[model samples]
Target: MSQQPPAQQQSHPGETGQMQPRPRDEMADYTGRDLLADKKALVSGGDSGIGRAVCAAFAKEGADVAIGYLSEDSDAEHTAELVRRQNRRSLQIRGDVADEQHCHDMVDKTVREFGRIDVLVVHAATQEPVSDFTELSTEQLRRTYEVNVFGAFWTVRAAAPHLAPDASIVITGSVNGLRGNKTLIDYATSKAAVHNLTYSLAQHYMQDGIRVNCVAPGPVWTPLIPSTLGEEKVEGFGEQAPMGRAADPDEIAPSYVFFASNRLSSYYTGEVLAPTGGEIQAG
Candidate 1:
């Protein structure tokens, strides 16, 4: 297992370079078998962390990529470089996924550049920890839900028309969604909604030959951890996991690739794959 340093905090919407023990998001050693040959993919929050890894993985599998993020131009450019290194076209779209118009624009720009979208990975999310449930403010709750829940809805809806048959939709859920988290109340609730949305959308689009699925991960060493969880929680981040350490973004990425590839997950729809360091939860 990989080792992570003690906790370090950053401002909201953290940068990957600012993170200590930088997350292994490059997908360096992964080899692909053209599972997504010539496919076009749009990934929200694709600038860093799990999204960055997923973009690289998709590119390695022969898919061109379009990344949408709030700002993070540098990180987005870097991710695009990685995709280009794999000889795939990369389009970088900057805007907040929480904005409905921005979501529509993201889809329009991506489709214009890539011709079509074969995979849509809604990985962008935001969270603010409230030490106590009562400490959660109305604004914080709304912001969290806006980005984590509604953002997914707006993004998917905007992209839905452009997605062709056999297209795949992958949503990033969390272990916190399956079971409540005392500290991450708003974040957990949003993710829970996303999980159910994945199920509902799977049924809604099944007739169109579209597949929807989710990957609910446990503690992952991403910029989101320190940025949202704070110093103390970051220090021993994944110790509670049976694996004793948070997973690297590189480690969590393959689950996305699996769901994105029809050759691998043809019969799977509305499924939640938990890569949670041995943590178990009932359905």
Candidate 2:
């Protein structure tokens, strides 16, 4: 147990610096192949959780990453330092992903820093508690859409113009998109939109050689769980999943790698990789 209660500090992506047990960002045994060598990529919410893992992985793979996060400056700076230690550059920016101006500026700043964009990982999301549909407030629905739907829209729209033909996009969805969790009606519906968004963008952009896809992860061990539910509920998170264990962030980052790498997944697009630990049935 941590000395401090899990501080409910409002934070942005990649901000695991303040968590009791800092999120296991890079796996001890993992090695890299320079797959993303010389590439410049962007990761939203890259200060912590799955986004933080992605940033570390990108660094190991020889890419300088731009981390776009919310308000967690300390966490974002820590993530940047870790990336720099891996001999790759890290640009940490703090802003709301829901802002269209910030969305455009994120891409602009990345291009200014790195000259061009090679990959865009849309991973930041907004979620709220909802028990019943009748109880859903219009503000809640709109805010959810702004963060989940419009956020992806603006990031991609901003980055699209500068990307090379072989650019890749990996949007983050949720397993709830697969099985509608009633309590997450708004959040789940937003994820569903991302699922469809990936396909639409993949089809429309295939001719341009830019692949768009999504990864839907099950109940992984992340702050989102503990922050939403108290510390007690966090323990049994993955008991229901077939694997009977919550995914570590590293376990989830590989899907992004598979999607981002041209050597491994060049022929793939409009795809959904469910890292849900056998929760999805075999086709």
Candidate 3:
């Protein structure tokens, strides 16, 4: 794959099939060693991008999965197919994560299907970039926080009672969260709130032996890019990073796998693992 994607654009909440250079989100070449054998996971936004890769990786590791997505039925079905191919059960629940009831329903359906939740991945997010802060609208700000921050809160709260010791909750933050983005004002702020939520939740769940962590990645070739960013911005998406290129969903997924597996991250919680393509950040 090339380091840069050609200039392209798509409607909001883009479909993976419509992407010019399809995202590498299937985890196709990866092999599993039953790291998540018999476990069950619920991944919000599991239809595409990082969420799609995470679902594939978890299935390969021997876990049944329930995918929560919005209106992207085709993408969600394709993701479920990937999981089913691994002989793991997959349940697709389509609804907007921004809806409080929907978030709760996502967890409820996953528990009903799998009987319990071993992993909860809060990866559903929305972003729109504005060249100037003045162009950022109140509506956009509310929507961004509703999906990126509020949804994460609702999903985790609903899943809390069902999570036991050794259960893991992984929130998807962004490099922009640690260091702000000039154009992505609302999105960056929402993600920063999410990172803080991971820290707070980790402390709250520590006594119960449940781990909470975050994976904040740099630019990754995902549907969200071409859909939300301007055509020009999508052209050289991750060039600002020290690596001068964006990551593939495949490259970013292993971080989620590590956080999901207790055997690998037993002593880690409230940690933010940033795969920023060499962009260094200071605490």
Candidate 1 vs candidate 2: which has greater lDDT? 1
The local lDDT score (0 to 100) that residue 63 gets in candidate 2 is: 90
lDDT of 1 at 43: 98
* Candidate 1 residue lDDT tens string, 137-229: 999998999899999999999999999799999999999999989999999999999999999999999999999999999988887888787
Residue 89 lDDT (model 1): 98
What order do candidates take by lDDT, descending? 3, 1, 2
Q: Give the poorly placed runs of model 1, Cα more than 4 Å off.
A: none
lDDT of 2 by residue, 99-154 (tens): 99999999999999999988899998877666568898999899889989999999
Q: Give the TM-score of each candidate.
A: 0.98, 0.92, 0.98
Pull out the clashing pairs in model 2: 13-45, 13-47, 14-46, 14-47, 14-48, 15-47
Candidate 1 vs 2: which has more TM-score: 1
